[model samples]
Target: MRKPAFHRADERRFLDERGSSGPLAPNGLNPATIMEKAVRERIVDSYFYKEQCFGVNEADIVDRVVEHVDFIGGVTGTVQKPTPFLCLAFKLLQLAPGDDVVDEYLRHGGDRFKYLRALAVFYVRLTRPDRDVYARLEPFLEDRRKLRRKGKSGTSLTYMDEFVDDLLTKDRVCSTSLWKMRRRDILEDLEILEPRVSPLGTLEDLLEEEEEEEAMQNGDDANGQGHDGDSDSVRSVSRSRSETRPRSRSKSRSRSGSERERSNHDRMDVDEPGTQRSRGGRSP
Candidate 1:
């Protein structure tokens, strides 16, 4: 018998593909490594093209980074170990104008001034820090009416802020109804970001309301009707006070998902950095 045509073709083809006459690892490349390389390339192209003046649009940059932001926010039980890409993304978003994300960021731990200033300096080349974008933001500064307050910390306007604020304002007005209402959904994924609106009352407000409730409770107790007092009445009083007291706007909670609605946002820093495990606290 003679060796037939195309005999051992599979073996030869495999060697040809590898550019070697030997076997190699079946998977060929590590996914994590590939992802890392890809992210690095994109960042260099997007943010570090020194010669390319005024490169990527700030709005576009923020949109691209939103995924990383969400990833950083969702990782619980750990002090989110963000990759360099994630860190860069965070830096970009911070520099990007738009209070939508910044407002949410303020809810997280730490002083907002430091983070905001750091990002502003990195992108805008400002000599000092400015807490409020509304003041020196390029587009807003041009429009005298929108210049609500002076720039904070003596920082000047940056192109990044101008781009972001414009994007946000435009999205609110010209974009579809969906985009206008989509901030809460986008913000939900971030761990540090919270509803900008506050659900709690001020110390004074709480005290006053509590006093009122106590008075009502005392009257009922004296009449021997404390136990028999209508549950609705008690709820009504508390709820009324809660409603009337000036509150920082709370983010709207979605009731459609029963499971999510029932879940609390609080975390005990379980397995987190900057925190020690303690027996006194309830389970995370």
Candidate 2:
């Protein structure tokens, strides 16, 4: 009988091609044991686990990720039932898909179906070696798409980047304890990993650049209006004042001088009474 490609021929084969399995039973102690016992138990007991997740192959898992998986979480409901998302995660661990299939899952992370990519990310964090995990997951830090995450703390909004970061740095995620990962700097120091380059670069530098651009733009706007518009208005105001002020001042001085001259002419016309009498006597 020909078996499917994802089904490993080695002893590591946990599920046959038909995906036959007993409830809560795993073939070995590697990945199935990686998840906590309580979480594994809840997942196996879940109705979604019994109904939807049963007999799912690697291809079927993708369909489930696209259709059924919405929120990333370990358990939901007040009674603490395992979520369908968690059930599929356990299913992947149980089936142990090959690296190529996992890569295919990651390749679809470009906004059409982000939840599926998240599923692949969680699986990679758990299964892959620490170095591979960092190398695989670090590239996706630039993915800032929003995601809905459900947990014991209730549902909340989270970003794709934030979720991947949690898987790397946080001790526990989705109600499962994550293995401690080496610090990124330490790995870079040992020459194990290249230094991480931030996608947005330094946030402070970006803000400063934006502020400078706005300032330059405002300066340009001021110049645009002031040079052609306000400058002429200001000059006209100054010119009108200069032309009218001295003319009024000169007119006032001339009127004052004429008044003084009129006073002197009246004084000359009205001779003194003694002078008039002397002239009359001399004529006699």
Candidate 3:
């Protein structure tokens, strides 16, 4: 007969038996034990599930996993888990892209180290290490190697290369800190001086460059010669007095009361009973 699944298969079996929902452990271990198991298993199943179910699209899942790992890894001070855990979580994430229900069960205080390690591996893979993100991450490798050198008590690096390569090909749901002294040493070796914007250019140059781009696009449209046969109806109407009426047209239609009074007076003088005014405004 096949041996039982690792951890609390019997308790899991019991939970299945009672059909009761409660705070169940991955095996029979309590929270601390669970964390310990993460170190050994090299994976964090629940975290993986939670990430896969976060309602992200397939294309976005890897990025989301990388982001989550970064956020958590930064908190944990390192991203290194047991190889077994990493491998399993990686496989599960790849398999569960269509299942969007994992988020419902997410809880705080889970295993941080496992997920953090997963995230770093996932990030290295997602960015493919050929771009700027990889360049930024190169600084972290010494810390990583040291962590691995600490033996199983620390993080695992054996499968890192494999994990990274797999991340490049897999649509996987996935998922450090250290002190300044060692960080400084690593930085010195990597030649990563603090970022500096050189005297070669200024913010004004950037703005001018943007303006030039926009002007060039507009000029391209204006200089194009293929539309000469197109109708000029809009321009024709705008330029024609018959088609373009002044805003005062309605005012003229309903002449203001003062102007109306003036007109009435002038008409009355012309049509008076005993006097006649010539069209030139003189009485005749």
- Residue range with the least summed lDDT across 10 consecutive positions in model 2: 9-18
lDDT of 2: 0.80
lDDT, candidate 2, 7-122, per-residue tens: 33232234322234423322223675677877777777677877777677899988887778888888777788887778898888877788888888898543478988899899
lDDT for model 3: 0.38
Is candidate 1 or 2 superior in TM-score?
Answer: 2
Sort order, TM-score high to low: 2, 1, 3
Worst 10 residues of 1 by lDDT: 172-181
**Residue-level lDDT tens digits of model 3 in 65-168:** 44443222211224553232343333333333221222211112112343444443443333222333234343333322112222224434444334333333
| Highest TM-score model number | 2
Model 2 residue 149 distance off true place after TM-score fit, in angstroms: 1.1
Clashing pairs in 1: 73-191, 197-249, 198-248
For TM-score, candidate 2 versus 3, the one ahead is 2
Stretches off by above 4 angstroms in model 2 are: 1-29, 109-111, 202-284
Q: Per-residue alpha-carbon lDDT of model 1 for 1-284, expressed as tens digits?
A: 99776423122232134334333211232112212333323333443222221233444444333332211111112332223223343234223444444333322211322233223322321111222222223222232211111121232333333433543445321111102223433544653234333245567788999999999998878777655567768888999888866442332233335546445333432345434445335455
